[model samples]
Target chain A: MLVARGVTVAIKGKTLLQDVDLSLSPGQVLAIVGPNGAGKSTLLKAMTGERKTTGGEIELDGRALWHWTTAALASRRAVLAQSTEVVFPFLVSEIVTLGIRRNLTAAEQYRLVQRALVAVDMSTMSDRVYGTLSGGEKQRVQLGRVLAQVWSHGCTYLMLDEPTSSLDLSHQLLILRLAREHALSGGGVLMILHDLNLASMAADEIVALKDGNRIASGAPVDVMTDDLIAALYGVRVQVRGVPDGPFLLPQTARLPG
Target chain B: MSAGGVAMPAGTGAASARRGGLMLAAGAVLLVAAIVAALAIGPIFIAPADILAILADAAHGIRPTEGIAMRDAVVVLDIRLPRTILTALVGATLAVAGAVLQGVFRNPLADPGLVGVSTGAAFAAVLWIVFGGMVGAFLPQAVLAFALPISAFLGSLISTVLLYSLATREGRTSVAMLLFAGIALGALAAAGTGLVIFVASDQQLREFTFWTLGSTGGASWFKIGIALPFFAALFVGSFWLARGLDALAIGEAEAFHLGVDTQWLKRLAIVLVAAGVGAAVAVAGVIGFVGLVVPHLLRLSAGPMHDRLLIGCALAGGALLLLSDIVARTVAVPAEVPIGVVTAIIGAPYFLYLVHRNRAALGG
Candidate 1:
């Protein structure tokens, strides 16, 4: 399990998050939902030790995160940022093989990279140059790489920040389902998702943030309500629950007298 | 799946670009052959037959026909061999340095000499030159001999550290910042060097000017000996780093998250660049753009893998520089042109064209 206690963070003299307490246990999918500039990414960074915590600490297995070396931390959790751009061109398999750097044998690394590509449905394009791929294709490949990293070292926590922003609807759903599958297979995923419907559908738990404060946190069914959505977004939104998932559509705003 | 091209993954909207392996192999073989031609051609125009005789005799202790003087053998083995080998060494070092820096910063415009490393070396070399001469009367002769290149190497290290620090933010090196800082510091160090030259006595000024112009005019066996091993070490280091560099090719953060240790990789790149730039300029002074041109040429055929690109760049760079050295000697006969002049004349226009074509690619 991963836990953050009173994790306050500030960058460049500006507070990004305040006393944020978050935890991810095994088999949990916690979807962080918030608008732009709501510190979702910063919170993710804090948890991942990518950004320093101004106050408090993150604990993994009851030990403070700072004590772990970079390699140790990397071996523990996997992180995927919004976008990655390559300067030189590399083959997809060669690129994915880096996910297991210094940890796996050469042959084992190659096999894992191949498996990752296959898992992401990118096995056919293993020899493709990474630079020549389009945005959506790159996203899938990056997803494959991230999965490769997680699988290579057996990270319990997978942190993804807007991983589906550049993806089409189908790939988005595929990735979310993959994350769910990953969680079901004895791993945990913490994803920052902008789409509330996606969060309500895929997330077992939802943590909603607004202006650096946690507005609510609970099971998606209990926390996702029409009144909460209207207040959080400053607009009216109707929520309909279907067997497949929750669907949300924005409606005209109405102010209280 | 593409016959000659890499197919795109699920989301990328277009087909992947694939450079043919045959083309890459042909290019590498062609470059190796070019290196041989470079070894063959020079001011005296040693015929291939005579060249073989000279080498075979040296290797197997088989003397040439009675008509061929010991002077010819001495000239070939002593004079031409050192200069040609030094040319190849300096060329490989600079080109490999450039290629590594490009990967380190993720900038296509990176060139070792152009990016302040040589200027830093020059600053140190010039300072030591002036100071040693000032203290020559009192100091032991041993102190004077070792001072110049040692200072130069130190200067290179300092400049790299500064450039790296200036370009880094929150533990990440920004390519745009690196380029800007490099250019700015390069200009500053170069200007400082020019000022030092301006104030130097005419005789010493001539030496400094000629050093900057760069030549294989005064070939020495010692310089070649020093450069050879350094270049070899750097070549091996670069080749070993091929996979890590490939990881960085996709971007720094991803590479870091994937456990490639981005900062360490960059630091290693800088150290390699330092070693190469230090040894090359110390041995041959500042030769422009071998670093830039050879990598671009190699990239055309090597498919941008640092593994292939490293070896290809080394061979091509060695060949290109040696050929340029040959041309510089032959074009002017007894009054040889600076090899640097030849490389600059060839590389500058191509560099300009690349800049124009990839204007958008080099942006922030």
Candidate 2:
């Protein structure tokens, strides 16, 4: 279990997230849905111990997050944040290998990395310099990195903040599909997505945020009501349900300035 | 230049033990070549074999043959030896420190000395030189020479702490912020050093100017003794950090979730950078661009894994500075060029060449 209670985060006197409580359970994929700047990323960070909680506490597997060493936490949980900011060029294989550093040995580690690369279908680009790759290519390599992390340390909790932002349509589906399969394998995934339709198709549960609060959360079909999205985004939205998932449509009904 | 078998998912053989062995052998060869080249080009032109004999005798303080001449002995041991050793020490230290700082900030262009570490050292050394002259009657020259490096070290330590505190935001350092803070602190330190030089008497001004120009004209065996341990520590520490740095290259939040103590790694890096860059400038003064140029060049040639980059940076830096020192001492025959000038003259063009050739890579 991954849980955060009454977590508050303020950056430079601007309170981005306030008193958010969340839990990500085993074999469940939680899609954090919200408009831009609604603290979806901040909420994920607070839960994962990336952002310091000003008020309450966080726990993973019934122990306080503070209790686990950072390395231990890494093996237990995995994350794929936004774009990396590395000054030096790095190879894709080198980047993926870092994900397996703490848990696996040389032989097993390489095998796991190769497997992770294959999962993302990026096995052929492993030796390419990460900087030399295109944005989508780099994103897949990063996914491969985290995939290696989870594969080596089985059943790890996973969080991804906008993992699909730089990806193309095919790779995006490939990545989200992989995350869902990972959940099926007993690993948990919490993803913050701006694409509500993508979330509807991919996530088992949807948690919606507005102005730093967990305003809505439940099964996708239940939480993605037209009333809720219109209220959340302040833009009229039409919610459609399909056999596979819910589809959120940007409504033509603009209610004046 | 060998992109090493364009196959992706490079099998075990790609980063295998063989590649590591090859890099190590290349490093060793380059180092030996640097040593031989540096020892060979002085006014007397001693052969590599004779240079080894000179080394063996110098170990026991034995005199060389009379045919080798008193002038040559003084030239090799007192002049060239000190300069060469000091250059190697300072170069290796700066490159390792640069590697750590760049990784800590996750900025490829972040250089340790670029952020005011060296100027801080320079500032402290200036303060000592300007004020300590008043106590010449009380303090022995040996003690004064020894104290300068300490003051420089303290200066580096203070500036590093300040830079770290200011650059850090939400427990992570942004490279742009760190770079700005470094420039600000560097300017401030430079102004402080300038103030001291501006107010001092004419002769004192010349001394301050020469010191900042960076040289090893006054290096002794004792200073080498003091430098070796820090170099070794930094060398070992750099290898340990290579993995952490590799993790950090993919964003701190991801690295943190991967189990790296991003905060602790950053703090440890700041301290290491302070000690390494401080001790370096203390011994040999400010040698610019060796840190910046060496790593970029290594990355360009060897590919950019910290495993390769760190070792390549250290060995290449050691060789580069040693070669520059040789040029400094021999280029003008009897009159010596400041080692700093040699590095600057060589490094600036090399930097320009990299920028010119890799304009797209540097993105202007």
Candidate 3:
């Protein structure tokens, strides 16, 4: 389990995240939804120990996050940042191989890379140059890298910030399904999602943030209500209940009626 | 599987790995050829058979007792042998340093010579050359002999650290800032070299001029011994950095996510380049482009995988320097153009072409 309590982050006299509390447990998928600059990424970075929290603390599996060495933490959790820029022209398989942190033989490493590539549906393009890949393909390749990192670690956390931003519709659904499958298989996932409907479809619980504070948190059906969406994004929306969660449709002023 | 094409086998990298290995083997063969040419093609022109006989005799600690002339034996064994070894060592150091720097900076254009590291070391070496008498009065003879390379190493280390800090922000390096700062640093070091030259005696000035232009004409066994330890440090340290550098090609934060200690990697790479390039400059005096061009060529042919890239750089760097040294000696006949001039003549044009190709990247 990963936990952040009253975590606050301020840089250069401007607060990026304020006194937010969250926890990610194994066998669960948690989605953070917010407007731009609502600190969804900052909260994830703080939990991953990428950003130092100004107040409160983050703990991973009952120990402070700072106490864990980088390698040890990497074995327990993997991160996919919003965007990764690779300057070299490494092959798709080579890029995936970078994520293996264990002492595997070359054959074993290759097998693991193949498995991860298969998981992200990039098996056919394994020999392609990463630089020549389209934006969506590159995003999937990066996802494959993170997947390869914690492949054998049974209870690792997968932290992704906007992992589906550049993905096409089918790939986006494919990633969400992968996240759901990962949660079902006894690992945890924390994703910062921009599409509320996708979050409703994929996440077991949702946390809504506005102005660096969590405005609502519960199961998606309870937290993603019409008034909460209005408060969170300052837009009026009609929320329809579904078996999966609450689906939202933005409604403009009804033509000034 | 959904597509009609066949799925790639699990060992997809095997073919490329084999090709890379073959390229490295080819580089080794080229290096041997360069060594033989460098040993046999000097002013006296010793035959390859005579060169081999002299080497075999030297290996057994026996004097030449066959058809070889005593002058030929001395020229091959005493003069050309040490010079060839030093040229190879300096070349390997410069090229490996270049490869490592480019990885650390995550920019293809980074090189010791182009970034003012060699000039920085040269300036300190010039200071030692001009002012050694003042410091030599109190120090032991042994310690005084090493003062030049030590000062040079310190000089390179300072410049490398300074350049990194000036160009990097929040873990990302700005290529524009790096180049601008390197140019400024190079000019400052050049001005400092001129200042040191102004105070030198006529004999010191003459010696310093040759050192600045760079040469292997001054190569000797004792100088090689001075440089060998630093060379070994760099050679061993680079392999340790190879994996970390490969991880770094993504980005610093991303490398950290991959469990690389990026800070330690950067520091060690900087030190390795400093020690290697500093010692090279102390011995050969600012041999340019070996660091810059050798790795680029290897990357084009072999690939940018640092493990293979570094090994190729060592071989290719040595071969290149040996070939350049041969040209330096024979191009002007008895005049002996500096090896640095030979390399710059070859390297500068390639560098301009690289700049032209990368103009889009550079504009930002």
Q: Which one wins on DockQ? A: 3
TM-score per model over all chains: 0.88, 0.87, 0.95
**Residue pairs with backbone overlap in model 3:** none
Ranking by lDDT: 3, 2, 1
Worst 10-residue stretch by lDDT in candidate 1 chain B? Answer: B11-20
Mind giving the per-residue lDDT tens digits that candidate 1 earns over B1-364?
1233334344221222235345456656766665556556665556666666787888987776665667767767888778777887788788888898777767776777667877787777776666657766776766555555566667787888888789877545665677688888888877877888778776664465445657776668877765555566678888888777877777666666655767787787777777777767777877888888988776765557687688777777877888888788888777878878999899889878877876675571
TM-score of predicted model 3? 0.95
- Give the best candidate by lDDT: 3
**lDDT of candidate 1 at residue B16, scale 0 to 100:** 22
lDDT of 3 by residue, B38-146 (tens): 9999788888989999999989999996799999999998899999999999999999999999998998888888888988998888888888778779998888777
Relative to the true structure, candidate 2 reaches a TM of 0.87
What lDDT does candidate 2 reach at residue A43?
Answer: 83
Worst 10 residues of 3 chain B by lDDT: B1-10
Poorest lDDT segment (10 consecutive residues) of candidate 2 chain B: B1-10
Q: State each candidate's chain A TM-score.
A: 0.93, 0.94, 0.96
